[model samples]
Structures are given as structure tokens and as C-alpha cells.
Target: MSSFRLTLERRQQVSTLRSTTTYILGLLLGLGFGLLVLLSAGAPAATLLDDLVIQVFFSAMGLAQTLTLAVPLILVGLAATSAMRLRFWNVGIEGQLWLGAIGATLVALSDFGSESLRLPTMLLASAIAGAAWIAVPLILKLRAGVNELVVTLLLSNVAYLLLQHLLFGAWKDPVNSFPVSPRFDENEQLASLGFGNLHSGIYVALGITLLMTILVQKSRTGFYVDVIGRNRTTALATGIPVTATITLMILLSGALAGLAGGLIVIGVEHRLTQTIGINTTFSGIVIAFIARFNPLAVLPTAIVLAGIYNAGGTLKVFYGIPDAIVVLIQGMVLLTLLMVQFFSSYRVSLLRQSAQQPGQPST
Candidate 1:
């Protein structure tokens, strides 16, 4: 008689082609599973698939809306990537985003700059605010040896409360008596690009993506990030300015998240509201992980996510599918991808146990 045991082993090397194929397979499997789930729930599978494909990709209006959503998604994804490179867990991206929005709102409401300069001023202020918001957690982590994850997560609640206070008290729109800031001035708002809900902010998002790609792929900072991520102790011993690099990357992460908030206000919402950047933290983390934390991959990943969000909305509006089901489907897709990613890096093997065990028992 022979007995076998299952063993898990990490792959020594995974080719790019193989890795990509596995991820693609994972996506197909996830989508297929989602289809089955919807069908089981009595959804109109035939028309639903067609509508999802047409509306998310083929239709001009759908593509426009997707691009609009992708702008901030791209920004937030970059934010996560920035922190991830340094092995920093920036769980407060939502809080940083709110701070960014607040910064932009202050500029818009106070008329801080001339009409011609208002938009630029708001953009600058938003980035600064985001950086400032993250600085607290970064300091605590670096100086006080605190856990940034907990601090950042807690700060998100604080940021939300602050946003609520401002909206309900100081910034409420007097005309509508709503818990929202005054609409941005024409000059302060991101201008339309002659498309459905698409705005000039897409250009900014694209440009930033390009810059980040360059930084991540070609710069010393990128090299430092990789080294630090692999081994922080080795990075410090090898004369890499680990502390400075960590600080820079974390701050960059916060700034990018903040910029997304500012962009949402001027580019999408055109005003600050309590609902601004809702679910952004999860979306950012999802996009970052799906893209494998590659800056160049963030754009396409963001578009795909934006399409899912758009499709989810369509399902709710057309089919009356509950939000919970949509969330579950999203979770399934993410979970599938994660499982596939894990398998790509590892393999399980069955090994036969040696017969010597019987001789040893006899002895």
C-alpha cells in the first residue's frame, strides 16, 4: 500500500506570458461565475450580457461615463500603488480624499484666486491638503512606531465626520438648503470635452498616469521602492535612504488620493458633499491589487473597474437587482482573481510516502 501527501511549493520563476494568461483565465472564470449567479437569481441573462457589453464598451455614452469614473479610479489606484511600493498600508485613502475635496472647496468658496487662476489654485490646494492629511499617520508610523493601518483607518471616520459637519453646517447650499457646498464656478469646474459627462480632468488623469509609469519604471525612486518592498532591513543596510523613500512614497500616495477627491469635486460632483468619494478606499485597493501595483497597468484596470461599476448601476436601474447581489458579484470576482494570483505564484504537488515508515514501525 502507498500513501500520498499534498505539499504546497512556491514557484521559482513565473514567466510574464504565463502570469498574464492565468490572470485572464481568472477573469473569464469570474465572469462566468457571475453570469451563473445572475441566471440563478432569475436575471434576464441573454439581454443582460448584451446590454453589459454594448453599454460598457460599444456605446459612446457608456464609454463617456466610464471615462468619467475612471479619472478618479486611476488617481486612487495610483495612490494605493505608491504606498504599496513602500510596503506601507495606507488604509486612510478615503480620509485623504475628503481632505483634498475640502481643500478644493475652500479655494472655490473663498474665491482664493483670480477667475483665470481659480481652477489651478483649487487643484494645488487639494493636493496639498491630501499630503497634509497623510502626514499625520506617516509621522506617527515613522517616529512613534505606531501602526499606520489602524491610524489611517480611524482617521477615515474622522474625515467623514468633518465632511458631514462642514456640509450640514457651514457649507450647506443656501438655495436648496442641502448638505452640500455651493456649486463650483464655471471657471473652477473642470470643463467638458464635448462628451457625455466626460471632462477635461481625463487629460490630467492620463498625464499623471504617464508620469507615474515613467517614475515607477525608469526612476531611482522606483528602484528604491522595489528594494524596500523586497526587504526593508537589506534596503537600509545597502545604503538606500529607506526612511526618505518611505516618506516620499507615502506622501505621494496621500497626494494622489487627495487629487482624486479634488477631481471628483471639480470634474464630477462640481461641489463638496458628504457622499464624495464614497467606497473610494475599497475601489482604490481593488484597482491597485488587480493591476499588480504597476503604474502602467492602473489605467486599463481602472477602466475595467469603472465598467463594472457602470454595469452594476445599469443592473439596479433596469433589472431591479438588489445592491447586495451586485456587491456579492463584485466580491466573487475579486476573490477569484486573488485565488488565481496565489496559484500563479505557487503549485501543489502530491508526493508518495516512503515505505520505510513500515520498517521503522517494525523496529
Candidate 2:
């Protein structure tokens, strides 16, 4: 008689078939769960399906809005992907986005910036502010070895509070009587690409994605980062400037997130609102993960996520579904994909052995 045991072993490399299968399964499972929720809610599954698959994605106006929403997602998704590639977990990208908006607001509202310099200065200010926002966490991690995930997450709340304080007090729109800031001038706005609801900022985001792809996939600094991600000790022993490299990567990540905020202000919203940029950071993280940290792949992934998220309103209207369902769907997809990622890196099997003999541990 033989006894059997099941064990998991780490894989040296994950095959494309395995990776692809994992993503497909995640997609199907997530949609299945969403369908169950709709049925339980007594909602029409047909309307939900049409809203999700046709209205938001196939309609002309809907497609425009989807791409417009994807602009910020693309920027922030690329930002997260960059840091994630280096194994730097930056959960404060949302805060960086808010801080970036603050910086742009400071410059945009200032009389010192001439009309010619106004927009450019605002964008630059936002990026610099974003980088500055992440600098604190990076320094602490490098010096005191504190956990960045906790610090970054907490800092995000601080950033949101600061944005609220300013909007509710100094930056409050005098005319609107709302908690929103004054809208940017005509000269400061991004033009549409002849498509209603879509802004030219999508082009800028696409260009930046291309540049980042090159920097991360081809540059020597990027190579160092990849190695560091694989093994920090090995990278350090190999004479890589681990601290400096990580610092640069973190700053750049923050800058990208900041730029995204800036674009949202000048392109879509044309002003800062209480809800203008909420939850974007988390959605961007999901986008990055779904894309597998590939900067180039982030384009389609961002668009897909954007279409789904932007359709939340339609789902609510057509099926009486709540916005929470959208969040739940995002979470489920992310969880399933993460599980697939884990499985891709490991193999599971059963080993049988004689009951009379001592069995060795399975690798």
C-alpha cells in the first residue's frame, strides 16, 4: 500500500499557455460571480450584459467617453507598473495624484505665471509635487527600513485631507457655491480630438506610455531594477546602486501619477471636485496588475478597465445595480488574477510512497 501527498513547487519560469489560461479563467470566473449577484438582486441579466458589453463598448458616444476616462488610467497604470516592476509597492499613488493637483492649482491660479507659461508650469509643478510626495516614504524605507506599504497608504489619506481643506476654504469656487475649485481658463484646457467627450490628453498618455516602455524595457537602469526585483541581496552584492535606483523609480512613479491628476483637471473635469479623482489609484493598480506590469500592454488593459468602470452608471440605470457592484467586480477580477499569478510561478503535484518506508519531502 502507498500513501499520497500533494505539494506545490516554485517554477523557474511560467509558460505563456499557463499565464494566458490563468487570465482567461479569472475573467470568466469574475463575470460568473457578477452574474450571480445580478440574479440575486432580481435584476435583469440581459440589461446588465447589454450595458456592460454593448452600451459602454460598442456605442459611438460611449466609446469616446471610455477612451477619455482611460487617459488617466493609462497614466496612473503605467506609473504603478513602473514601480511594481522594481518590486516597490507604492500604494500612495492616489495621494500623489491629489498632491499633484494641488501643485497644478497653485501655479494655474497664480498671476506670476504668464498665459504662455501657465499650462506648462502647471504640468511641471504637478509632476514635481508628485515626486516630492513619494520622497518621504522612500527616504524612510532606505534609512529606517520601515514598511512602505503602510506608510504609503496612510500618506494617501493625508493627501486627500489636504486637498479637501484647500477646496473647502481657499480654492472654493465663488460662483458655483460648491466644494469644487474654479475651472481652468480656455487656454489651459486640452482640446478634443474631433470626438465628442474625448480629449487630446489620450494621445499624450499614449506617447508617455511608449517612452516609459522604452525606458523600462531597454535602458540599463531598467535592467538594474529588474535584477533588484528578482533579489535585493543579489543586486546589492552585484554592485547595483539599490538605494539610488529605487529612489529614482519611486520618484518617477509618483511623477506619472501626478501627471495623470493634472490631465484630469485640465482635460476632463476642467476643475477639481470632491469626487474628481477618487478611487483612481486603486483602479490604476488593478489596471497595472491586469496588464502584467507591461507598459505597452497597459494601453488595452487601461481601455478595458475604463470601459467597465465608466459603464457603472449605465448598469445602475438599466439594471438598478449599485456602484458597489462595479467595485466588487474589480476586486474579484484582481483576486482571481493574483491567484493565477501565484499558480504560474508554482507547480502542484501528488507524490505516492510506500507506507513502510520514510518519505522524503517533495520539492
Candidate 3:
């Protein structure tokens, strides 16, 4: 009698063709899985494709909304990519964004700069605030060798609490009696691009994405980051300024995350609210993973995710399905893509063995 066992062997080198094929396959599988999830959630199967694909991507209104929503998603995706490049998981992205919002809010309320320079000043303050917020976890990680992941994740709660304190207390709007800040002046808000809900902030997000791509793919710091991500010991052996390089990248990450928050306030929300960074960090992380942490890929990945989010709304309106179903679909897609990555890096095979009595001779 023979028994067969399955084994997975790591691939020493994966070809470009195989990689591309696996990526496409993963996307298809993920979409199929999402469809199944929708079907189970009581979505009308006949119109699912039309609502999810045509209505979301083909129509002018849907395209505009998706692109508008993609703005912050792109920023967060870039932020996550920057940190992941150095193996620094900045899980406190939500906190950094909130701090960025706070910074921008301060500028708006104080009328800190000339009308012409006010928006620019607010942007600068936002980036600085974001970098400052993440510095706490980065410092502990560098100096005490603490896990940046844990520290960053915990710090997010602190940031949220601070945001709540401001909203419910000092920052509350007096006239409306709302837990929100005063509306931003017209000069402080992002200019509309005359395209549905789209704003000039889309241009800003695109510019930052292009700059980040260059910084990561063309600059010397990027090379150092790649080396460090592969092996810190090797990076140090090669005389790379490990500490300084990480500090730069992680700060950059925080800045981008913070910038996203600022964009939401000035570009979309026009005021600070407690709802500012809700669940956005996780979506950004998903976008980064979907893009395989490539800066340029973040744009397209963000658009796809924005569509999924829009589709979720469609489901709610058309089929009365809850928002939680969309979350479940997103989770399923991420899980599927992860499995594809694993299979792409390894090959599975079966081995057979024959069993015989203790004294019997094997043929």
C-alpha cells in the first residue's frame, strides 16, 4: 500500500511571466470570491455585474466619484508602501492622519497665513504634524529596539482619544452645537476641478505619488532601504546609515498619511469631524498589499478599491445589504491575494511512500 503526502518547496527564483500570471489569476479569483460573498449576502445576482462593473466604472458619475474617493486612498497606500519598504509597519497611520488634520485645523482656525499662502501653510503644518506624531514610535524602535508595529498600533488609540477630546470640547462648533470644528474658509479649502466631486487635491495626490515613485526607485536612499529590508545586518555591514535611513523613510510615511488627512479636511470634509480617519488606514494597507508595495501601482490599486467601496454603497441602496458585507468581500479578496503570493513563491508536489511488514523485503 502506498500513501501520498503533499509538500510545498520554496522557489529560488520566480520568473516575470509567472509573477504576472499569478497576479492576474489572483485578481480573477478574488473577484469571483467577492461575487460569491455578494450572492450569499442576498444581492440580486442578475444585476450584480452591471452594478459592480458598469455602473461603478463605465458611467461618468461613478467614475468621478471613484476618482474622488481614490485621493486619500492613494496617499495612504503610498504611506504604507514607504514604511513597508524598510520593513517598518506604521500601523499608526490613522493617528498620524488625525494629527495632520489637527495641524491643518489649527491653521484654519487661527488664520495663520496670508490668504494666498494659507492653504500651502496648512499643508506644510499637516506634513510636519504627521511626521511628529510617528516620531514617538520611531524613536522607541531605534533607541530601545522596541517593536515599531506594537508601539505604532497602540499610539493610534491615543491619537483617536485626542481627536475626540478636541471635537467634544475646545474644537466644537458653538453655533451648531456639533462635535465638529468650524467650516474652513473658501481660501483654505481645495479648489474644485469642475469634475463632479473631484477637486484640485487629485492633482496634489498624483504629484506626490510621482515624486514618491522617483524617490523610492531612483534615489540612493531607496537602494539603502531595499538592502535594509532584506537584511539589517547586511545593510550595517555595508556601512549603510541604517538608523538615519529608517528615520527618513518612516517620517516620510507619517507625512504622507498625515497629508491624506489634511486632504480630507480641506478637500472633502471642509471641516474637522470625529469621522475623519475611520477605517481608512486598513483600506490603505490593503491597497499597498494589492499593489505589491510598488509606488506607481498604488494609483491603480487605489482606484480599484475606491470602486469596491462605491459598489458597497450601491449594494446598500439597491439590495439593502449592509456595509459589513462589503468589508467581508474586501477581506476575502485580500486573503485570496495573499494565498496567490504564497503559491507564486513556492511549488506544491506529492510524494509517495510504500508500507511493508517489519520482516518483509521491499521490492
Candidate 4:
């Protein structure tokens, strides 16, 4: 008897050089596919190229807006990366972000804090709210064997509804018909960086990104997280505190998302409006994946995504290109990256069984 078999085995260790190459190739392929789509949509190739290189990226304060948008995207990327690194799916990043804004808004509206204490207190409140939002799901995950992914996603809607309730009801600005909170005091807002719409939040985002990169690449806790992610059984056998590590990571992830929310409120919007919530959660997920969940890579990835977001609006106005085109490109990038990851991580082999010599089962 004979049998044919196909198998896939992971590489014992993949080199950083090879990993980088794979990512670059994936990015090129994604852009190429996006170009084809644009061509099919009646876009002129020369103008497309010009807009992509100049107007969308560098012209007319484009870079500043891109960097500003990147602030929250970077934090959201870090939050998603932390949970994903542990093989845990924290899809509630959007919810955590909204909770952060809520926390910040509550503090901003309160009269208990002194003017000097306002900003710090608001940020702290945001972080705590984000962490607390995740804590409920974490309990479900650990004790009830529930899946965090579904819980987090559903909770995101809840966060949105909660935000709407406050905005349309209590937080509604009396002077205007809009469902928005009062403008934040100058002392409570983040200091500007003397750039177009850019603020100190960018520095905060960069600092956090660097710190996360160091923690993941050069620390013992990072090693433990890696082991647990690779093999839970092995991690447990090696005396790693899998439960505690998971808990810590979950809380940290939520806190980072909350920080993003606070940053958006304090730095950009300056008020809680009906539209002022985590609209970039999907974009952050894209950034994290494009960076291969590497904390160090997340910064550049976030910048790239932020460019697309900022530029897409420009394209809509100047080139008449719909916003959906940008979305199509993002989709292509995500799909191509997944394909690249699969090919780079595993190899398939075919085998044929030898003829059986006895009555025993064929081997």
C-alpha cells in the first residue's frame, strides 16, 4: 500500500534579514495590486503617481496632519500588538479607546480638580477607564473560558452607545445645536509642537513606542510572553506564570488604547463630540499586522497608514478619487501581508509511503 502526504513545518529560527525582505516584498505586492485597482477605476497613472508622492504625503501640511493622526494610531497599534503577541485577540481596541475618552471627558467636566491638576487627572482617568473596560472581558476570558475576541468586539458597540448617550444628553453644548461637550480649557489641552495641528501627544506616542520596543526585545518579561505565545504547555512546564502574564498584558493593552483616546481628546478634538471616538481602530490593526506585531516596526507602519488616511481625503478633493479607493488599498495590504506571512513561516513537503511487506497497517 502507498499513501501521499503533505506537511508543513515552521522554521527553527528565521533571520531578521529574511523577515525584513518578506515584509518589503509583501508591501510592494500590496501597492502593485492597489495600483491595478486604481487604474481600473479610471484614474490616470501619471496624476496618481504625482498625488501619491507629493500631495498626499508632503505637500500643503500633509506631513503634519499625517504625523498628528499617527499619534493615536501608534498607541492603538501598541495596544493591539501587546495582546496579539500573546496569541490573545484583543479586538476591543476601539471600545478601550472610547472608554479612555469617556474617562477624560468626565474629569474635564468635573469641578473637584484644581486647574493645575486637570490634565494629569484626566489622562489618569482615561487610562483607568480603559483598563477597567478590559477587566470585565479579561475575567470572562480567564474564568468562564469565553473568547476575548467576541467579547471585545461586542463591547465596542456598547462603548459607542455610552458615548452617544452622554453626548446627546448631558454633554450636549447648550450654546450650539451639536451633540458635543464644552471646549477644554487651555491648561487642560496638550501643548502644541508649533506645527500644523501637531501636539505633544506625538512625543508621548513615540516615547511609549520606544519603551514597548525595549520591553519586548530586551526584557525577561518579554521572553516569558514569547514562550507562552509559542507553546502554552511548554511555557507552563517551564514555570512561567502564564495567567499573570496574560493578565498584565491585557491590562497594559487597554491602558495604551485609553491613552490614545485621551490624546485625541486633549490634543486634537479638545471636546467629546458625536464623532469623537475610535474611528481608527481598524487602521491600527492594519498597522500592527503590517509591522508583524513588532513594537519597533509599529511606529513606521503607523506613519504609513496615517499618510494614507490623510492623503485619501486630499485625493477625494483634488483627484475625485473616492475614499473607498483607500480602503481597497488597505484591504490589499492586509491580504498580501497574510499571504507573505504564511509562505515565510512554513514549508510544505510531499511524501509517498513505501509498499507494505506484511498484513500490518500500511506505514
State TM-scores per candidate.
Answer: 0.94, 0.93, 0.95, 0.91
- Highest-scoring model, TM-score: 3
Model 1 has an lDDT value of: 0.89
List the pairs of residues colliding in candidate 1: none
lDDT of 3 by residue, 1-363 (tens): 889989989999999999989888888898898898889889988998888989889999999899988999999999999998888888889999999999999999999979999999998899999999999999999899899889989989999999999999988998877799999999999998887888899999999999988988999988998999999999999999999999999999999999999999999999999998877778878888889889999999999899988989988987888988777777777888889988999999999988787889888
- By summed lDDT, which 10 consecutive residues of candidate 4 come out lowest? 273-282
Q: Candidate 4, residues 1-363: lDDT per residue as tens digits?
A: 788989888988878887788888998999899989877876778787666667647675878888998899999999989988988788898899999998998998874499998888998889899999999889999899899889999999999999999888988878878888999889889999888899998888989998999889999889989999899899999899999999998899999999899999999999987675445667767888998889999998888888877867767786678978888899899999889877788877899976777776864
| Best prediction by lDDT | 3
CA shift of 230, model 3, Å: 1.5
**Residue 291 error for model 3, in Å?**
0.7
For candidate 2, lDDT tens digit of each residue in 234-312?
9999999998889888899999999988888878888887676778778878988888888999999989888888778
Ranked by lDDT from best down, the candidates are 3, 1, 4, 2
TM-score: which is higher, 2 or 4?
Answer: 2
- Model 2 whole-model lDDT (C-alpha atoms): 0.84
Cα displacement (angstroms), candidate 4, residue 202, comes to: 0.9
| Candidate 2 residue-pair clash tally | 0
Candidate 1 lDDT over 163-225, as tens digits, reads 999998889999876788988888899999998999998999999999999888899988999
RMSD of 2: 3.0
> What global local distance difference test value does model 4 have?
0.86
